[model samples]
Target: MQELSNRTSAFTDSVIRRMTRISDQYGAVNLSQGFPDFDPPKEILTRLAEVSMEGPHQYATTWGAQNFREALAHKQEHFSGMKINPNTEIVVTCGSTEAMMAAMMAITNPGDKVIIFSPFYENYGADTILSGAEPIYVPLIPPEFNFDANVLEAAFKQGAKALILCNPSNPCGKVFTRKELQIIADLAIKYDAYVITDEVYEHIVYEPYEHIYMATLPGMRERTITCSSLSKTYSITGWRLGYVIALERIIDRVKKVHDFLTVGAAAPLMEAAAVGLDFGDNYYKELQNHYTHMRNLFLKGLDDIGLKYITPQGAYYVMVDVSEFRCKNDIEFCEWLAKEVKVGAVPGSTFFKENVNHLIRLHFAKRDETLQLALDNLSEIHIKAKKR
Candidate 1:
């Protein structure tokens, strides 16, 4: 065969999804992928059932259905303290995955440099490559997952055209505080760069740690492209309902890119998820409580077993330290964990640009019984794989 495109050649299959398959193969309790094992909100499900028969089954507008976008605008404004125009400022996408990709395509030219934090969600790396942009990785130093402002400013000084911000960050579970976000906002303004955000866990944040929207920061609304989804918030990952919110000028470009990418998000799914977008603050409060309960249950189990892991302030994931196990390669260790320990986890290396391999990422987004099973399996790790 002729040579394939180099754009995709460097990409491996998603480590998260692969671990899910490994979990299935081994009958391990799957915590590697971050979807809930439970059903979505009953209100969303009920609306979906109604929409099934009422029928708008065909594609909606290239951007989104009018009602869905309006609901999204209302929801975002309610939380972010920024008013948004539903017509000109939003582009509904297949999911935040597409939202991020479309945002990259809209803003980036080949050979441009985009700043990405190390230990990021893996897709950000691929998105840069696919967009033909070179990535400048600024390490978010581990343990506390804080960045040195000087290091970050250096990346901006190097002519970075954009930066990807994942608040309530994945894999590491670091939620950027408002002060930290303000610093980033200042840097972005000083450098004349865009901030493309992945705020998928916006509503799933724990207490004492809040999700602050970059668009709401001073001098940032025009330069911030907010990519978020109903998947994580509504527990409807299969629905693939997500959107990009930016100033009208940026959103116009995103709409064109999004239109060519997927035509539009699913119509019936958008209608159903609008109900979720319209949900009151009480619903979000209850969501935080539920996730808090799950986090406590799973991490308490790890604590009881005498395992070491980072306690996340916001997101549902926890990074367990495996340095004591003496595993040279995190990938091999994760495979062994799946097969022998019967608990699947993502190798921490998959999410980092650095040579990090002493940690493994697991999520607690499952039901109580499911988490208990994974915890039971994990409790035997010392006996099964500990280096003598």
Candidate 2:
């Protein structure tokens, strides 16, 4: 066989998904992946069943269905306090994964450099590579998961064409405060670079850590390309319904890229998720409460097991310290943990650009019973998975 595409020659399959497979092979409680084991909202499921038979199984507009975009625009406007033009500013993609890719392709040239915070969601690395952009990683130092403005500004000084901001960040689960966001907004303005935000956890924030839209910051409305989805918010990960919201000019290019990429999100799914987007404030309030309960339950279990972890301020993920174990690396530790301890987790090293190897990420998005089971398995980590 001929040599494969050089651009992807060095690519490895996703570590997160790989751990999930290992978990299944061992019949371990699979907390490696972030998807919830519970059901989506019943109302959306009911609508989906209706749509399956009613029609619109064919593709909707290349951008999105009319009702979907309208609903999304209204929801976004309600939260961000910015007027959104559904007709021109939104292009629903396969998921936030594709939305990020489309936004990168639309804004960047092959050699352009993009800034990404370390301990980022894994896909951001792939998105940069696939878009043929060079990545300048700035570390969000652990424990508190805070970044140094000087380091960030230095990346911008190197002529970064854009920065990928994953607020309510994955792996570390640090929600960017308003001050931190203002600093980023200021740098983006000064550097004249675009800000591509992945705010998928916008509605899952815990108390005292609110999610602030980057586009809501002064001078950011035109420069921020918001990529988010209904997957996390509405628990419809399989639906693959996500969108990019930006100025008409940016979205015009994204629409072209999205059209060539996946054409459009599934029409029936879009119709169903539109019902979710139109949900009232009460729905969001209850959503936050439920996530908070799950977070508390899982954290309490970790505490009882004598495990140390960072408390997530927004997202459903928690990073637990495993340095007390004598493992050679986190990857091996996670494997042993799954097989011997009967629980699964992603090696924290997989999410970092630095040489971080002493942490593993577990998610609390599962049902209460599932979390209990995982914790029960994890209680044995000190005994079974500890390397001698």
**Native-to-model Cα distance after best TM-score fit, residue 210 in candidate 1, in Å:** 1.5
Q: Estimate the overall C-alpha local distance difference test score of candidate 2.
A: 0.93
lDDT, candidates in the order shown = 0.93, 0.93
The residue-by-residue lDDT of candidate 1 on 87-162, one tens digit each, is 9999999999999999999999999999999889999999999999999999999899999999999999999999
Model 2, position 120, has a per-residue lDDT of 89
Write candidate 2's Cα lDDT for 10-80 as tens digits.
Answer: 89999999999999999999999999999999999899899889978998999999999999999999999
Clashing pairs in 2: none
Worst 10 residues of 2 by lDDT: 379-388
